[model samples]
Target: MSSHADHPTVIVGAGPAGLTAALCLARYRHRVIVVDSPGAPRNSASAGVHGHIGMDGVTPAEFRARAWRELSRYTTVERLEDEAEGVSSAPDGGFRVALGSGGTVQAGTVLLATGVVDVHPADVDGFAECWGRSVIHCPFCLGEENAGGSWATVADNAELAGMSAVAFRAWSEDTIAICPETMPGLETARATARSGGGDVVTGTVRRLRHREGALHGIELADGRVLERQTLVWTPRQRQQPVVQRVADELKLTVDEAGFVAVDASQSTGVPGLYAAGDLTSRWKQSVTASTAAGAAAADAIHMAALLAAVHH
Candidate 1:
């Protein structure tokens, strides 16, 4: 059993990043308290986690179950199925994490693995059903599986539509860039799409034709139907409210895209505070990246504790 004062770390997420970090720290014999509520994984809507060696193609639920099972073997780790409502600095240079279930956790260090949230397009029928299956987010993760398949990019902005189309060209030459409104770079994106034997269309997606998450075509508001199979959509994303609240309290810096800014070591620029996973890097948002970040952050925390003990 570990006391609140004795716990070295409190992780505010149970996703890949936080779980991996806790596993590493457990191996190092450091007690860690991980806080996470069920049904909050950013990848819940993703069909399967791809690009992770050995664990590739594993469903998010199974991956999480495996992680929790592994963590259970370590007696030094504590798992709490609760959301961290807020984080504040404590008097002893530690952190005070307020839990949604009416309690406070004191820790010498805090790791913000609370990832971002994707803002899905509203009023789109069948979008929710086909989100993780036919509508994909990461090309590197899910592209190869659907290679040579008819593809479309349903983007709100022209840049995303064009970039997605250009990127999808490697997987499929028959790609279409679809945007709801005309914007700058659309023509360039359209040209790029055409260059790859693809096409571009501007229309609002009314409904997606799919059966049990398998996309068949995209129906437009004007009764136009694009005979496409898979859709590559990169919707707008935002930090979870808890993340923003913590960032505001700590005055943490954020990148231009509004992700929590962290260095190579996953340090939040505030001593003893760290961040990892999708919350820190958008380009490297994957199960592999998150797990690696978690491992690295664990090592850093362990080393920091060693140095502190020597100094004391």
Candidate 2:
């Protein structure tokens, strides 16, 4: 086993992205240390992971377990079940990762797979309980199972409301978008929704009604009820607190959309630093996308090493 002084690549966040990267690096006979905080994954509330090709319909826990099992087969990889509390520059030319367990790992390269955190609506009754099950963000992940049922697409803005409503219409024709009356683009939202066989309702969601762990309807503040089986809510999202802290320390470039900016090879414009998964793009935040990003980051690192050796 290589010691910490060897400066193995340190990967933060052990979700699909981090784990897949660790596996790829191990296959290349590169040393890696994966640090994962001890908590439920962001998608733990989800019943199962979808759009992951062969592993579709697997629960988040199951998917993680399978990845762990596969990674254990490699000797060059290490797994740490602790939070990465701080990140800083090492004495040498590498990076230093401080863990919650009062230890630190030295890394020649850093791959940040830390994903974003969804900001749930506050003061909404039953919203927390139904989140990830009945209340979801991604249609590709939860739409198929909830298909053919009434869906209510709730958004703070009319544009998102209309787009979400139209997207949900693919799984169910009984789709309606609910937006605040004061939000802009309501006319466009209404037109778009109508074109997709859906409707736009202007109202404030007072409470969500769920039974047996499933949402049944959405109650408006005006005592009106919109009978719906599922609610597709696109809430605001932010970077994980650790990712933000690291970005601040390293002065990493963050896009206007609040995501870490990375190049085609997942480089964060900083040599020996990379970021992948939802931290880089919000287009398709799925297990498949994450895995692909992880693989790309690993390949980039491997190629960089090869080029350096040839130059020397």
Clashes of 2: 0
TM-score of each: 0.93, 0.95
**Top candidate (TM-score):** 2
> Alpha carbon lDDT of residue 144, candidate 2?
88
Q: Note the residue pairs that clash in candidate 2.
A: none
Q: 225-275, model 2: which lDDT tens digit per residue?
A: 989998888778899888899899899999887899988899998888999
Global lDDT scores for all candidate models? 0.85, 0.86
Residue-wise lDDT of candidate 1 within 1-312, one digit each (tens)?
242235569999998999999999888888899998766577887768888898888999999999999999999899989989999999878999999889999889999998888888897898889887788886787887778779988766665666665677788878888875656777877776677677779988889999999899999999999988888877779998899999898899998888998888899999999999999977888888899999999988888888887787
